[model samples]
Target: MWEQIRANKRNSILLLALMATVLALLGWFIGRAFSPDPAAGLFGIVIALFVWMILAMVSFAGGDAIFLAASKATPVTKDVHPQLFNVVEEMAIAAQLPMPKIYIINDPAPNAFATGRNPQKASVAITAGLLGRLNRDELQGVIAHEMSHILHRDILFVTVAGVMLGAIVLISEIFLRGMFFSSMSRRYSSRSRSSGGGQAQAIMLVVAIIAAILAPIMATLLYFALSRKREYLADAGAARLTRYPEGLASALEKLSQNTTPLSVANKVTAPMYIVNPLQKKGMKLSDLTSTHPPISERVRVLRGMAGASFADYSEAFRKTTKHSTPIPSSALKDEAVQIRSAGSQKSADSKKQIRDIGDIMQKTAGFHFVNCSCGLKMKVPPNYKAHQVKCPRCGKISAV
Candidate 1:
């Protein structure tokens, strides 16, 4: 695990540096297009560095809040959802990490994710649909998977990478838009066309255009690469933490069968989810660009595990996928084994689970619940101002 963390750190640094270089080059070309002075390129580099720093600081400080808000997730208390809270607590303790703040997204997509700068500041957010669909062990599997992301520092790495990637895209967009709309750009082009070094300037312009177009794509590819690998590792960590590989395997199967697209998830936040929330249909070339490995493959690897150790997962991964380097050597452990095949457990009652989840979500969202004589529970929102409310199920009036 330490080796993997070190490797991720090194890779993150390299990736960020690569993004910075792209930004600097883009800035240099834009500056040179307007001014012939060599110092303009240096100025561009400085500007790029400043932008990167500012954005990085902002993302580090408040990205988690922004994500939660974007997803319409509300902070959840243990009292409102003791089962979810207990599962999170158990996973946190098993991973030997600080408890992450919990959130519940109101969406009905069966998905979950973890985010924050580090374990101390980490948070886990799951959709209401996930809570409704998954059984206790399945939920444990999902939570454990997210907790592994926190423990392994994948959240921090991904957050920093996302910030840098956003900066690159933002700068590139600014440059492209400026060139298209600014009169100064036209003047620069006219002047450069008339200069003695017109051919060189033309070449630089072409290079800049290509770089602007490709930088974001390249960054996204890198981000996806890192995301895919970290997911495999997180899965292994989850299996080790829960001592039940089948739990996660079964959860993956259930998630893959879910077809609902998450209303709040977008491209920027989709990769953070345990399962891709975008709900792509049919095999296409675009699947190659996905941030997650194929769900079926992940499930196969997990179900192939003969025990709950990292070594067992590693071996299973190799046999299942012919990938020999998914797990680091130092992280592998050989211990007592208890293996259960996928589908070994009985399915929970889905209607009951959905009702329980709805109640928990309503309570956490600050809705007042009143059970009427008609056996129907009425949920009044926090914004309701009336002192007395009439039951929708029964004509009985209830006092707030």
Candidate 2:
């Protein structure tokens, strides 16, 4: 595990540096395009650094909270969903990680993600749809995957890389938007023509324009590549931790079949999810620009695993995806792990799951629950102004 962590750290640093370089270059060119002065290029770099620094600080300090807030996730207690909390606890123990905070998103899209600077500070947020859909074994698989992210320090790198990517995209957007204005373009052109180095300036401007257009695309590709690689590692880790690849494979199959769009999801936050929440229905995520690898491919890799070890996952990944696994050789050298048998526990019916999830969400939303003698459960909204409420099903008056 330590070997894997070390390798992941090394790879993360290299990727971050490359992303930073892209941001710096984009900043320099955009700055020079706006002003003919060479110093303006340096100024652009500073601006880029400033943006990066601000985002980095915000992410390091409270990134987990920011993402949870963005998703409208509310912190959940064990009582809300005993099985979900139990699975998280079980995975944390298996991963030998500190228990991470848990939250639930109200959205119907079945997705999840982990965020924090480190394991101790990490948080896992799951959509209500996920809690309501997955069975115990499936939920355990998902939690194990998230716990692996916290265990391997993947969240920190992801947060940092995401910030850098955002910086590059922001600068490029600003430059492109500025270009649409005649005055900005004419000002630079006039200055270039006034100097004897008009041709040289024109070339630089052209390069800058091209860079502005391509920088975001390039950064996005890098970010997606990094995200996809880590996901594979996380999946492997989950298999090892749970000793049941089919659990996760089945969960992934269900997640892919759901067509409901995630209400709070956007491109910026898409990569954090276990499955890319922004993926369009029927879209192939195997493409270069997608944040996540193809769900079908991931499922195939998991289902094909011969055992629960990293070595097994690597072999399966190679055979199924036709790509070299990202797992470190040292981690794969651990003792062989025999896959465990499937659990005998049967999950509640779909209607029960949905009802339980709704109850949890209502509690999270501060709705008061009043039990009526006629076997009717009255849910009073938080906004109810009355001191008393009547149950429609049982003509019973309940005190607020």
Candidate 3:
């Protein structure tokens, strides 16, 4: 996981550097297009660049915090919502980590997110509607999935991307608003800058101007794709950590079927949630360039993991969730991942390892409901069975 974080950091730096270069080149071209002399144009280029860098950094940092606040999420304690609190606690212990702080947004939108630079500092937030709507198991499923992200170190990308990507898009819009005027300004100011490579510089200037025009658009697209892919990665990681894939599956199903999108879910932080908070009910993830995998695909891959070996499930999930080429059986079968050296094997206990829903239902006596394909858990209830009789999640007719 540390290695993955390091690698992700490298990818982020490379992307940022790439963006900076394009912006610098645009400044250079803008100056050359207007300058009377090479030296003066270069000076203009440097000043323009200095301004862009300072603003970009501020915008990136400020945007992330502002977006989080805008989502109307407030940090909560065990007293706020004990059920969700306990669920996160159990998952934290299972993952062998400190408990994450919890937040609840007062919205009917069914979505949740984990954020912070690292696990030690992370916080998980869910919508009020999700709590009111889902039953015990389904809610655990969602918390488990979010905990998976906290365990896997995926929050860095989730948070940083929320900020920088937003800033870039905003920058693009600001740029576009000025582009036409700027282009005309360039034309009127085009008298001086002809130098040794006059024609060459002219063509380069045109290319740079066009690139400046498209850079934000490209950056927006890149951010969306990368953001969305990370969600799939987190999904697969969550599935790996919790072998009870059905939990997350049900959560996603419930979330997807709902239409109440969060009003606070703007472009910046929308991608961090378990499901896209954009309110689109029927659209698949592939149909849009948003930050989440389609709810349908997420649920599908988790359910498919039901009885498969961990190796088999991981490969299948990567293929299906991320739409990547199938991994070879030989590669996935590497015992290094699942099995360890002599006397040091990590037990396959990484899984929730529980298959009997009845056992779980029996343990949690609060408001229990159970359903069976064989129509057993759901039978005619006694007269007093009406109160705590049936399983609400499955809509099963209850007798127990």
Candidate 4:
């Protein structure tokens, strides 16, 4: 685990440096396109540095808040959903990390994700549908997976990479638009024609055009590669934490079988989800552009685990993918933990579970729950203004 963390840190630094270099080159090319002076490249580097710093600060400070808001997730308490809270708490204890703030998205898509700058500041958010659909063990599996992400510092790494990738996209967009609309192109063209540096100017122009077109794509591919690897690591972590690879394997099956796409997930936040929330119908050309490894393949690897250990998962991954080591050699423990099934503790009452989840979501959304004398529970929305409401079950008036 320690080795994995160190490798991730190194990879993150490399990714950032690569992104920075791309940004600097793009800026330099644009500067050269606009002016003949060599000092223009340095000025462009300054602008790139400024943009990176500002965006990095914003992403570190407020990116999680922005993500939660964009997903329409409401803060949830243990009092609102004891089961979900208990699962998250159990995982946090197993991982030996601080409990993350919990949130619930109202959407029915079975998806969940964790985000924050560090473990101390981390948070976990799941859709109400996930709570309703998954059994206790399955929910624990999902939470454990997320907790692994927090423990491994994947959240911070991914967050920073995402911000840098966005920066690259923004810079590329501006350079492309400027090239199309600004007088810089015409000025450069006239200067190249009049001066002896025509070939050099034309070469720079081609490089700038190529950079503008490919920089974002390169950044995206790097981000996706990192995202996929972290997911496999997290899965291994969850299996070891819970001592039950089947729990997560089954959960993945359930998630993949569901056809509904998450309405709140966009390209920016899609990689954070446990399963790819975006629905795809047919064969994908390559996994290079995907935010996650194929769900079927992940499930196969998990199902193949003979015992709950990093070594076990590593072997499974090798067999399933026929390439690349999933677990670092230093991180693999010799003694394997046996899988403990939680089937006996899993609830079988689907309707009751659904009702419980609905009640919790309503409470999280600030709705008032009223239990009537007729043995009926009614929820009043925040927008409701009536002081007295009649119970729909028994036609008895109740004062708010």
* Candidate 4 displacement at residue 337 in angstroms: 1.3
Per-candidate TM vs. native?
0.88, 0.91, 0.68, 0.90
Worst 10 residues of 3 by lDDT: 339-348
Model 4 regions more than 4 Å off: 183-197, 283-286, 345-361, 371-375, 383-400
Q: Tens digits of per-residue lDDT for model 2 on 208-302? A: 98998999899889889988998999999999999999999998988998888798988878888999888888787778989888889889999
Residue 87 alpha-carbon offset, candidate 2, angstroms: 1.4
- Which stretches of model 1 miss by more than 4 angstroms? 183-197, 283-287, 336-346, 349-361, 370-378, 383-400
By lDDT, the better pick of 1 and 4 is 4
The C-alpha RMSD of each candidate to the native structure, in angstroms, is 3.3, 2.8, 11.2, 3.0
Predicted candidate 4 versus true structure: per-residue lDDT over 100-214, tens digit per residue: 9999999777899999999999999999878777887888889999999998899998888888888888888988887777556677567556567667777877777898899
Give the alpha carbon lDDT tens digit for every residue of 167-189 in model 1: 87888898878767865667767
By TM-score, is 1 or 3 better?
1
> Candidate 2 — which residues are off by over 4 angstroms?
34-38, 182-197, 368-375, 380-400
lDDT of 4: 0.84
Best TM-score goes to which candidate?
Answer: 2
